[model samples]
Target chain A: MPTSRMLRRATPWLMLAPSLLVLVPFFVLPIAIMFRNSLARDNPATGMLMPEITVANYARILGDWFYAQIFLNSLAASFGVALLTLLIGYPFAYYLARWAGRRWLPVLMWVVYMPILVSVITRVFGWIVITADSGILNGLLLGAGILREPVRILFDISGMTIGMVHRYLPLMILPLANSIAKIDPRVLAASTSLGASGRDTFLRVVLPLSLPGVVAGFQLVTAVVLSDYVLPTLMGSTRFRILAPAVFDEAIGSVRWALAASLAMVMLAIVAVTMVALNLAMRRLAPWARGL
Target chain B: MAVGEAGLDLEIAGISKRFGSVRALQDCSLTVRRGEHMALLGPSGCGKSTLLNIIAGLDDPDAGELRIRGAPVADVPPNRRNIGVVFQSYALFPHLTLRENVAYGLKVRREPPRVAEERATEMIALLKLDGLEHRYPNELSGGQQQRAAIARALAIRPVIVLLDEALSALDKNLREEMQIELSLLLRRLGVTTILVTHDQREAFTIGDRIALMHAGRIVQVGTTEEVYGHPASSFVLDFLGSASALPGRVEPGSPPIASTAFGLGFELTAAHRAGLAGPVRLYLRAEDVTLSREPTAVHRASPARVELSTFLGALKRQVIELGGHQVLVDAAAGHHGPRFAQGDAVYLSFRPESCFVLPEGE
Candidate 1:
């Protein structure tokens, strides 16, 4: 009986052992090594890492105007992507969660998740074909006399944003839909019955109740966009520098491993800070989200 | 604009709704007088909630007209209809404290903040939620949440308040307590209310009139005593409470003589036998049937063997086997009555007027 009770207590840890085994070495250990590398010195002459603990790499990135600009640009772009996806995804999520019929819900949800199923690289390439200067989109605009000349879309910030939004829109929508779906339809009816107008009910009841999902989706999309390497590298031109591509360039192209580790650390710090700030802001603004 | 019928706060006529192939409501019509409390009582999936939704304007009836205080509101949306609804879940906004939730409707209608605050405070006090104003919905107990939902509904001063299985979420004791508290509060406020519930006792407890629904149709609608004492059909008799139904045939006489298959014969009141001859079903309430050691005058008696006897606190319930059929008889659990055990021979007696006779298969 004692052994059985002890086994009962240890069951949860045993169940968790596999994931912990994977995460400790594959996730936590790498991060520990990366942090150590970030503080070490890189010998410029030999293109080798030297085991010397210092803040020179971090200081260099923080003090340099070029690195600072890339960091700011990455933050701005990630925020913009987060906002755009939310604007586009919230309505779609609301429709899917509240309005779609029993027969159509699964089909519509499949469509939302369809983009995620296709490889990201393939999706980015598909966007490239559509947004190229002489591609179908520009050709149609020209043919329809909407534009005299083809607009610059590929190799531009707009193109990169479009790709990022497309890639991450489902991430935003699924969470929003989950939270919105959890909202009892009866509550909305109650709001309306209490004399809140359609818009008023949504603003006062639906929106506030679904804030947990919004915060979740916003954090997910922002973090992914901040560290997203594929879309920026393929869609944006060389002049368009962001943190993810900058980190890739330093680590792979320039072989500045220490600097790359530091850059990666900065990106991780930004994501961590953003997540904390959003969480704190949500707690302050919509305290009910915590209970939810 | 077509005027509403005088003294009626709500009128639903010819309302029908179908979901796919399943009919949710079939031409359901009911009217509520101003300041009346009506209970829409039914089993689950009987379209009671659907009817409530249509009245609240949360759902549209496929073909029907709704009137609120003389105004035809078929075109009016839920918010504009000015009906307050408390859902079964109590549906209080989790984000808002009790005071804010109660004031939500007032704020939406653009009442001045001071007036909204005062009305909300008044309702909170009225519902005995004075100290819990700052607590969110999840923090409150079920009874408190229910009271808060009612408070929120009443704060708007709507013409009608609809409660959709509102008390069904509470435990038995809490539900009964709230039932009394809610009915008193609603009556004192003089708000025309429609309470939808599946519990018959809840209907009897709170409703001035009860509308019994079966399979998407309103089978009977009357005052609590009227519906309970004189059920219109076999379904009503069975649904409202526990009753022992006996299959029998009616033979015409000065007073119709009802005889069962096993040769037990009893006379039925002429009123109960009106328009019925041949086979019929006799419904006897447990309390209507009396179990005695011997036959007595003023009541027809039949021999029966006690199948089971249960002590139900205030009453002693006995399942008696009579003429190859089982009958339930309830007697007062007091010191004077002789207690019957299983397999004991007894006489089951009842007055002719207490029987509910309905045509077979009705």
Candidate 2:
């Protein structure tokens, strides 16, 4: 083959080399090391990694109902947060994209980005203050005589969901708004002029067109919620135990590195499986987008 | 042969619309008889589209009343108004196939599935989109997408059809072809229609009656020939076609005589000089002005030099400088006379009846 043709073919890979350089050392290598550590046994007395390779951690996790429950709980929490955020984010995104023009867009965007800018730990603490039994929410209700007593909200699955949605709502709204804003205004006018009501147009045209963004937002928020540590730690109680918090408790609190590594590996597997499932579903949902 | 013999079809009375400080439409009143094709012709931002949008219920007029078949439609929503529109972009749904897109309106209106399917099939066949019914919009070419859009618009059996520069997006050759096809289709359907276009040729091609709009007001509304041959104002004349204005004055008589700046005189009919007095501007179409190697006795020939000659296939357009005034004239390329070149002195001739004079300030 000609040198020019070979160089031309190699150009794309050369362009991708910089990204790979950053990803390999910082991301890929760390994950590989973590996976290796997960398969190795730890010295009980020395608090050091042993050379002996074993599948004891995996067996323990699979044989036990508690670990299985934790994985299931994590999936449930993430899925719930994704669904709830979509329901709330869709109308807001529509307003930003279709109604609000240059006038209020910047201000509205700042409002959406404000929560994400704050640290996740700070946001979870804020949720705790708001949802706690003796918090302002209960206080307000009690003062108004709407509730007989303080209702349970903090340190539960509901509290975790609220925190997750709050931290990741911007993720959902931005993509959805971007997708919707790109749609030609003529399409909307045509729909109206074709004897379709506003509701019908939105459902049949806007919703289907924005589904790619929906899938993108869902995947991002779900992945974040699945691997979340600070949110589950502060906003959730022992009654609502999840995978991320269990991994943290084993690693730092109990000084059990092997168990922590194994748990992290389990989380990695679950996230990978979920991502693959979501991709398949997205392909089916938005065939026109063609892997967008 | 009275129009609207069944009843008055669509009537818009004193419709006025404003965008911020810009007045888009100002007391624009128009009446469309059943099966009449009216074209709102204007330049961009001349309120032609604003009027169409108001009539289609896509927009609300600040001050006016809209009545369809003698019933007020102010409170009726766009969907409930039963008006169909073909947009400039065609705006076909990307995800839906041609058949589904055509059937969308009927489905939304809750028509029975079988009935909707039959109507969609008939419309698809009518628009000659037979085998392409299963293809998505992205899979179709520009012309096919346009036909699908038209099919979708007409499927609902709307009370009125509004075409917003519908053929403007297509290429020139295809646009002309579609124009002829659309004109014949509209005539066959005999549905009351209003088309908005900035292209004068397009307006002349499709419109039975033409309404020339300027600066948020309807300047003139008449039959195509009436607007073209006897424009109500200088603005209408200029918008409708290329014309050179000759500053002239009306001389009173049994049949009045008009003296123009070209050192020529024209005999005008009494009806043509009814409300005119003193100074007037005579508008002459490019084709009406003829060139001669020798002076003719019918109309006084003005000596001019050709500044520019543009060969446009069959018709050659020339810019001739007559003394201090410049006038445009169109001559056939295959004419028997000697071909005039740049800087060539020539005599210009045109009949008085070809002139459309507008009074000062009109």
Candidate 3:
């Protein structure tokens, strides 16, 4: 029991010590001071910080459904962005892993992941030009007569997803591509040589091996979408309060520290539950993967 | 399956392949007969494996047509070729169970689940792999995985089964065991199998007909007995140079005799041309000729010197320097006639039937 306590006591704080070296003073101290500052209500009776802590700041944010609706909308919008990123990324990743011949594999693969090297803001700006009301996409669509008017695609959830996907696409693609690459080409060849047509090889060998990468990518892109503070806010309505934006609104924008901490806690809980659920599902399918 | 669909008479017509500037094969052609267990034997980079790949449709021939049962494969893709190939690495699906891997081809052929499972089970049992059906490839040892690969190929009941140095991955003892087992299994199945190996012993051991490949071309292809006993070229004599050669010229005699160093002559009275007399080479297998203390009924005792004698199992195969580069002769141990000491002179003679006269080269 003493040894167990010794290990337990020594492990986490020891692990946290390096992080806390930067975090405790720089991250934690600023946040703590913010929490202390938020509690101090500006009173006409005092010239300094108020002595009494109050729940009045918390009451203001939660008092109306308009504020509550913003949180829900941000959640929906971020979830959409994440799922959409996964949809467009999966097939491209599969191509990178399979159809790219071995000779051109490395160079072609770099094109798939080349976006990651640039800044997120630059990517957002790139999406702005791409999906602008009369931009290249709309210009092409209008020239084809798919639309009568140059459709306004900017400053919307669709536009935001386009931006987010452009940024987050790499996260999803890398995992899915790794899975597709790990698939034994012989497995498909063996299947086809036995008389299964082209479609059958995909259904039997190509899809199954890429399952782990799909799940891992979904979790990654989803968590990333939820926690992203910049792209959604920069592109969409200010009322849409995704977890990351809500944290930013309280901790930096409005400087209400308690609300930010509570939102952060909720985000962590959601991620933890989602990961645990996925891990359990993976355990059931581990036998199917042949230890891959 | 029917016996009619079992064998494949493959005519590989002028197959050539080149990658970049390096030619893997150059205008190689071979005719493999129906139901023949042929082996392509060569060293690495000799294109033996490349030839096997071309036959199996794994690699395309740049300049030739591949014909199975006399039908050219100009329009058919590899998957439609219906050829079963056993790779050097075996290439068993690591993800599938031993049973699943074998059953894969059957399933792809759309044999009903019950029939596929039944046939797979039968094949597994036939190959004596019944107990470990559920095991994945990684769980099984190399030999077990190899058997599984063979079983998988056989499950398809293909017209041709190709093995690309399939036994080279196994240890020596395991390879020998599989060689006999695999050849016997293929014969029973009647699956015209072509195996590639660098090892001549394995080629001779498993092949009903062996083709010795040198530099992308099949130098010789024949039965084990023919390839060994009557080597076509000096390339073969050098390849099968396990014994010694006594090069001599045929002069006049009642029975033809070729003379070696210092008037050493080997007399032959077998069914050879009576008037054939010239400079010729005689190939003596180390095991075929023997030594004796005196002239026995079957053998003739002549003079020799035991320049170097090595004890190898039941007999001592001595290298007698009949002048240069020594000819090998098998002598029984504990023999009389002074046991010819090193550099000591004695008479060396062997059977007339055992002395083979080659056409100068082999």
The top-ranked prediction according to DockQ is 1
Candidate 2 docking quality: incorrect, acceptable, medium or high: medium
The prediction achieving the highest lDDT against the true structure is: 1
Misplaced by over 4 Å in model 3 are A1-87, A90-103, A134-136, A139-146, A183-188, A238-240, A286-290, B1-8, B240-362
Over 4 Å off, model 1 = A1-6, A143-145, B261-264, B296-302
- Candidates' interface RMSDs, in order? 1.1, 1.9, 2.3
CA error at residue A169 for candidate 2, angstroms: 1.3
Docking class of 1: medium
Span of 10 residues, lowest total lDDT, candidate 2 chain B: B1-10
- Across B231-306, the per-residue lDDT of candidate 3 in tens digits comes to 7666676676465777677876877666765545656676444565777776667766655445544323345556
**Pairs of residues clashing in candidate 2:** none
| Highest TM-score against the true fold, candidate | 1
Clashes of each: 1, 0, 7
**Tens digits of per-residue lDDT for model 1 on B268-326?**
77557476789888888998888777754422355678999898989888898888888
Better of 1 and 3 by TM-score: 1
Relative to the real complex, the DockQ score for model 1 comes to 0.78
- Please give the CA lDDT of all the candidate structures: 0.89, 0.86, 0.74
Q: How accurately is candidate 2 docked according to DockQ? A: 0.62
